[model samples]
Target: MTSARRGGRPRSFRSARRVRHRLAADLALLLVAVAFAVPLGWLALASFNEHAGLRTSLPHPFTLGNFQAVLTPDTTYTPMFNSLLLCGSATALTVAAATLAAYPLSRYRSRFNRPFLLTILFATCLPITAIMVPVYGLFVQVNLIDTLWGTALFLATAQLPFAIWLMRNFMDGVPTVLEEAAWTDGASSMQALWRVVLPLMGPGVGVVTVFTFIAMWGNFFVPFMLLLSPDQLPASVSIYTFFGSYGTVVYGQLAAFSVLYSAPVVVLYVAIARRLGGGFALGGAVKG
Candidate 1:
């Protein structure tokens, strides 16, 4: 009877402790969800509230004027176009460069590979602000300042190290044996990369593309510092126009623009959502 009581007491105590831990975790997650949800809720509410201030509340009359006001070419269309152009071009360049760079690192063994990868990792950690001064001077020397293509090129360069790192890791998941099979079938290295490895690693490529595009899309400081012309500025920089000359801000319009500004990213994610979840799809490619 004494042994039975002792064992029962310990088991009950452990069960209670586990319940408490689970409750605490649930509470923490709820708090985090609320923290994120509140701002989004505010943004949705304020976008329709014409006289909306910083407060989160329903629109008194629920207006569509804010969206109408920002829908004009100068306010929304042109800047969005610029953002698409710059980010799209830059993303393409970054993905291509990363694929090429990562291929060698993923495939070949070299004494310098680890050191080179470490250097790339270190480069990814660099704050763009730290290098802008020198980069600005170099751009000026090369006559690239205020140029859209120039800005896109720099954005691609800035995103390359991280993209390369991600691509190499993804590339590692693809079996080298697949590439060897291609070689046995009389394919060149490039052909094997294109026809064999890339097809197998579709999800990885999509991930890298989405990541690079999103990073470049939201990057304000780089474009603001490099591109001087107002006409050439992306939506990221142009969004600042919502601020009034004084300390006042058009909150409703700002919220509306913010919603619109975020749309492309949402759309991009949706477009690739299937592929991102597709995994490697390499299950039956090889046989024992």
Candidate 2:
């Protein structure tokens, strides 16, 4: 009886301590989330503020005037449309190219394969600024300046190396026997890839889509240098037009435009989060 009583008290005490520790961790995480969310909340609030209220430290007299200005037919709509088109096209091209390139790299073994994979990995590590001058000159010679197709092509190529590397890693997790079995059943390589491999890679594809879209949408430097016409500009460059070297910054319009620009990415992230859960489950099944 004495031993039982002693052991029971310690176990209960440990349980209580663990509960307290878990509660503390939860609270800490909640605080961190709040801290991160505050800036985004402020930005959202500022987007609704009137132009006169924008300069004030505290938000007062909230109005939709900023959004009205931002969404006005004559404002930055054309650039926003261009940005969406460019990002969508670039992401599609990147995924298609990467999927084709990654399959061979993941499945094959040869001396040349190692060097080729290494080259792609090395390219991913290289800074974009290092090649900008040369790329810009080449684009100029090709007469690709100030065109949406040109920007999409550039972004797709820039994103391709990283996309290939990531897709290769993802493909490695899939079993070769699955493809082999399909081939034994008289499926061609293309058929095996389309039916067996791609369905398993849904998670990687979602990840690639989200990442490529964000990168292409937010890229400012490339568009700024390549696009000379306002109508050809993307949202990233058009947003900067609200502020100039010597002119007064239109903080209200800028904030509103930023909120609008970020909406699509936020929605995509949420959608991808749902797909990611399923992706992990599928990936595990493929691996097992």
Candidate 3:
């Protein structure tokens, strides 16, 4: 340290270098933010603009027709209802299964857990496209095709591996001393989990629930493959009809449809954000 100081690089000079590096990082992040925000900004702008096709221009008439166009019975309302039911059911199932599965995995010490966790991590990365063929065949044999509930179940299962992984981490973070007290009070594991652990882990549960709902809400291919009937289709699949293979698209109506279709997911995110406001903290669960 003395030798370095003798080399004439003072502490103030090093601090100045650090400040410059931080400023450079801030500038780089600002550029990246702009890159991401541009498309979203355009979408919002175009949604209000009449006839805003592929070419971008200010809304001459500045009409609300796009919103009006997409809010019809068949285009928005029915499909939105279907999406809510499907996504809500799937998120509930995923959280329940994850909570139960995580409890055992978090509490138990076993030689198999590391490998099981690795397998789950691997499964999380598996693309839906790669697994669809066997999934389709299995559904056909089990009579699950064309059923909305069946589709929701599959979506829940597909989201399970990651959910289990996340829930396990949350469960592990909760101090075992709390559970010990519950056990001392003659409470069963389930009772302790319900009364103690869950109440404390609200933020984590909210995170998993919101993410699972969003994933299922925006899922297009799974429902399209499973739900054969027109009326049964969710908004994600229904929205595709607005675009064309030959570049003949309804840009104005499509933008409106996209915004309307996206509202539920946004609302869900906002609600969850409020729930997770202070972040996940175990607080005074353990008395030092």
User: Candidate 1, which segments miss by more than 4 Å at Cα?
Assistant: 1-6, 10-17, 244-248, 267-288
lDDT of 3 by residue, 1-288 (tens): 889778988889999999999999999999999999878877777888887776666776798988998888988998898898888889899999999989878988999889998998777777776777788889899999889999999989988888888788878888899889999999998998899999989888887888778778888888988887878889989887786465787787888888888887899888877655676442221111
lDDT of every predicted structure (CA atoms): 0.88, 0.79, 0.83
Candidate 1 global TM-score: 0.87
TM-score of each: 0.87, 0.81, 0.84
Greater lDDT among 2 and 3 belongs to: 3
lDDT of 3 at 158: 87
TM-score of 3: 0.84
Q: How many clashes (backbone atoms < 3 Å, residues ≥3 apart in a chain or on different chains) does model 3 have?
A: 0
Please give, for residues 229-249, the per-residue lDDT of candidate 1 as tens digits.
Answer: 888989999988777465788
Give the root-mean-square deviation of each candidate in angstroms.
6.2, 5.4, 5.9
